[model samples]
Target chain A: MARQESLNVSSSPARRRGGRKPTISREQILRAAEKFAPEELSIPALAGSLGVTHAGIYHYFSSRAELVAAIAAHASRQLEPPPPGPWEDWLVEVAFVLRGHFSQFASTADLAAIGTSVTFAPLVEALLRVMRDAGFTIRQAGDASELIASCALGGAVVLQRPNFDAAALVEDLQVAEDSPVHELAASAVDDDADAAFRRRLAVVVAGLKASLEAPTAS
Target chain B: MARQESLNVSSSPARRRGGRKPTISREQILRAAEKFAPEELSIPALAGSLGVTHAGIYHYFSSRAELVAAIAAHASRQLEPPPPGPWEDWLVEVAFVLRGHFSQFASTADLAAIGTSVTFAPLVEALLRVMRDAGFTIRQAGDASELIASCALGGAVVLQRPNFDAAALVEDLQVAEDSPVHELAASAVDDDADAAFRRRLAVVVAGLKASLEAPTAS
Candidate 1:
């Protein structure tokens, strides 16, 4: 509970009791962080696992916000989507990459949660940059980025959530027999979910292009 | 909290003590519901406001879930988007209509919350029927619908939440001055929020159109 200022933890690994140095690195911290969900990430808990004080964790990230940002940025860097050739394909690639990331943690990200806006800044930047490269003006890019984020998050929800199941949803519906929903159920054939999401992503990218006749940015 | 079976409530307004009939109607209940946010809605609280026992409220809605669904449906019924002119336009109209509805209560609908999927069934049915009439296969329409829902919900969050302020967000950015995000801020001029959302909705519609060469449903 105490700040433990006596612990001389700084840039490098800290000197423990008896001056024994522990070899900790940014890579080590990030790797350890991977084990916990983003919401579960705690500097004190993390330091405990690494055999260090919370101050030692602070050495790598000056604040908890900084630490979360680092994790987000790290993930962004690791993304290897198809080179931003055609902007639409790039968006599709990024959306799928995001799905992979969302699925990895089995975490439904609460975009409305405090600090989440910052957490997604790296993502928003990457999306905007890619669209800009394709000639979207900052205005166009910014507006479209918000829409794409929505699709990406929404796609993740539809794909991962059990409530979205076609048959189950049909079964749970409160509509009557004469309802068009009954007719709709007959058409609810099984679909390749990944393919379905990619199609939606394409629709979003294509829609963005259609909204802007040509890339308006310099 | 008591059931109060002695209150003698049913389809007609209940007779309170001394044989005086209290004429509480569904319209009265719905008008009152408009005052509370969706998450704040409570049956017992609502009944107390209407001067009815819980059983009397049940006469109108069998359960809390039914009451919520009724509220959702009532809202949906009140929506009058520009008629389904072109399929793209239809989707755009619905998106804007949805924006109006979401903004009315300052609600960001938790599509992931339990029973929300059921609550949205009416909205979904309408969306699918319009797309179907426009010749979209069920699969294309379903996929497109999910993406559009994302845009609608995401738009509400960005437009309503203070955290989305571009200047404030830029100030909070941990990126270096050399970052592209810095350049992005210069282009962050004020925009007509409604127009921006419409453009994105248009984009979504256009993308959906582009994805399918032609609708293949019977």
Candidate 2:
């Protein structure tokens, strides 16, 4: 009975938070910033919209850049955990998740681009860990991480815009018979971009292994 | 003799404007915009820096957006035409030229993003013409042009960042011993990335053709 009532209340129109002590949490702040992005949004404007003081925000974020970084971190964390499987298969799964995550929060890419100076190091380090565990040497891990993220993020940014639809973009690839954009598609000259991605992934992995085998340049 | 004097007068810092009159021209305005992009750069700032009244710009560009669009068009025309060859062989060549073009004008990508809205229709038509001429079917030409342009442009935007050293980025992929970045010694992962890009491009091309052959779902 309590669960049913809570669901009903949660689904109702958002309550106007005026008459009470503003209980703005970090999540709420991040959510607000994400909502107002790609527009002429300012920290003060966000605070005003949330019925909170600008000064109060400093309790959570030290600066506007920091706030943007926090939002990026929040958005990045929203991505699902990489699936448990063979390294090759899991790598593709991870790329797909990343593609979806970036698509969902495409505006955040621009916001994150501006705030990159803050501390993407932590997130980058985490990414490296995933790659290492997936059988990549540190250097191979580094390049693979950068390339994968770039493709996914770049693809999402293109997909989210008005002129670029993500599904249509994938459909254009005509990758597989059962599911054209699915993992089953063969690497045709014009149809299977995923095949191209996998080939690239394999090369990076092989290169990394070769580099590891020969530490010094020949 | 006048041309010789103009070319040789470089020893003298002081030279008359083009060894002729200072009358305004469309080329002159656009050239000035390109030259002044590195400094004070608002519409008014560009006009002021050029020692012209803001209204004076209207003779060449009717609006600020038009002025920006013209600069982008100028840069686009100045870009190296994609090399004529096998698709894979020339694709990286195209990517390199695009990277250089975007890097030349720091904010040109952002401007192009805005300008594509106004120019997409005509641009698409021209792109289709080029692709068809290059051995693609009407549909393959249409879809491939859009997808490939997006990839190249998106790659450029990501690669032209302050942290992204293009020389370093491509070093691993160059197979030739004489390549400059090859001296930098690419990580195994970077080699893989080069391979992956080739595969991805192939897939995109093949998929595009396949999609052309099949009827798209309703």
Candidate 3:
């Protein structure tokens, strides 16, 4: 149904241009969008870059928000979770898939803030399947899915920021060398953002496993 | 030294007013700022609310960014961690304190994005101390602190967005009622944002415990 809707929208330009095939496909537009960072992507700019009129772009995506949503949908389709395996391995693959997706299209983070919940169904389904297979009840699996999705997207936002200098922030705070904040900042300098995210992911996975094993009070 | 610097800035107005004592103090201004949401906070707006001239506002905070930093610093001071206890209890308290702080000042989420590494020093110190007492090495403690902090702050960001209707999003996706996305969205509707966050925090704490007890791979 979504594909049909996308096709109908994309074909409008060709229809208006007297039945000539549309000069551009939705896939081509998304590919062009992929070239710019989320912050730098604008429809007019994208159209200009593609050598198409602004109206041509608008025929497919009515507004920038719609374009962003389409981009998120496109990215979601590209995410190929590894073949089913141990729950732990499955989750690790999920995390890498998410990181790769968000890293490639940074603007998805912004969309997630507003409304990308629907676009995220595929990834959420994959996580849910893994958790359910690992013995989480439906309710538990749902909560876990939300938790993991939120963390991955949130972590991506932190990592994708234009400027994040832990050392500079520490210096601004004027903390002593022995302070915990100083230690954290110094350690952050040693590890890249991706490593830090993976460490966090490990903690989250471990935490979930322990919680699942413990008998619930209810 | 920080206190001296604050005094120097706050006292400038008094000196400019022929030593008659400034009509407002930095504390008074901060008190007013605390009443407004972070996004609503502005130097001129705050000054207007306080019945002071815009110039009077600058006598203390030089810019909106400086004011936000001061607000974060002030919020940090107000975060009094409980005396040493079980690591779980300590982390739970930290999460609540952070959520309370960020919820009270919405813009702190934005600050957390930019430079929470500094503002969060006290809470980080408290968490580090608790983790160390629980037998985590310095490096492990540092990584755990970052993970927990990131989760708490990141969760807060997700919760604080202006409009988040999971059901509406599900409807927009046009998924069948039995579909995994529908199930996830429906389940999400049943759990309030705070409960979801607490669940995630529980997982982080559990993860930390498991990691600490596991024999080091190194």
Model 2 residue runs over 4 Å out of place are A1-37, A43-70, A86-89, A100-136, A161-218, B1-35, B43-70, B82-87, B104-218
Q: How many angstroms is residue A163 displaced in model 3 relative to the true structure, after the best TM-score fit?
A: 8.0
Residues B80-161 of candidate 3 have per-residue lDDT tens digits of 7867778887787777766665545443333323234224467777787777778887667876765665555556556655
Sort every candidate by TM-score, greatest first: 3, 1, 2
Q: Compute the interface RMSD for candidate 3.
A: 4.3
Worst lDDT run of 10 residues, candidate 3 chain A, spans A109-118
Among incorrect, acceptable, medium and high, the docking class of model 2 is incorrect
User: For residues A79-146, what per-residue lDDT tens digits would candidate 1 score against the true structure?
Assistant: 55556567777777777776665444323222332113323356667777787787777777876767
State the lDDT of candidate 3 residue by residue for A46-113, as single tens digits. 97788766666776787775677677666676667678888876786777776566545443333232
lDDT of 1: 0.61
User: Candidate 3 — which residues are off by over 4 angstroms?
Assistant: A1-37, A41-78, A100-120, A157-171, B1-37, B40-78, B82-84, B103-120, B161-164
Q: What tens digits encode model 2's per-residue C-alpha lDDT throughout B61-144?
A: 555545555666556654545546665445445544544554444233232332232222333334445555555555355334
Candidate 1 per-residue lDDT over residues B41-153, each given as its tens digit = 88878877777666667777876655655665577656664665777777777777665554443332322321133234566677877787776777777776677667766
Q: For model 3, which pairs clash?
A: A207-B207
Regions of candidate 1 where Cα sits further than 4 Å from its true position: A1-85, A100-111, A114-120, A163-165, A171-180, A211-218, B1-84, B101-111, B114-120, B212-218
Clashes of each: 1, 17, 1
TM-score of model number 2: 0.46
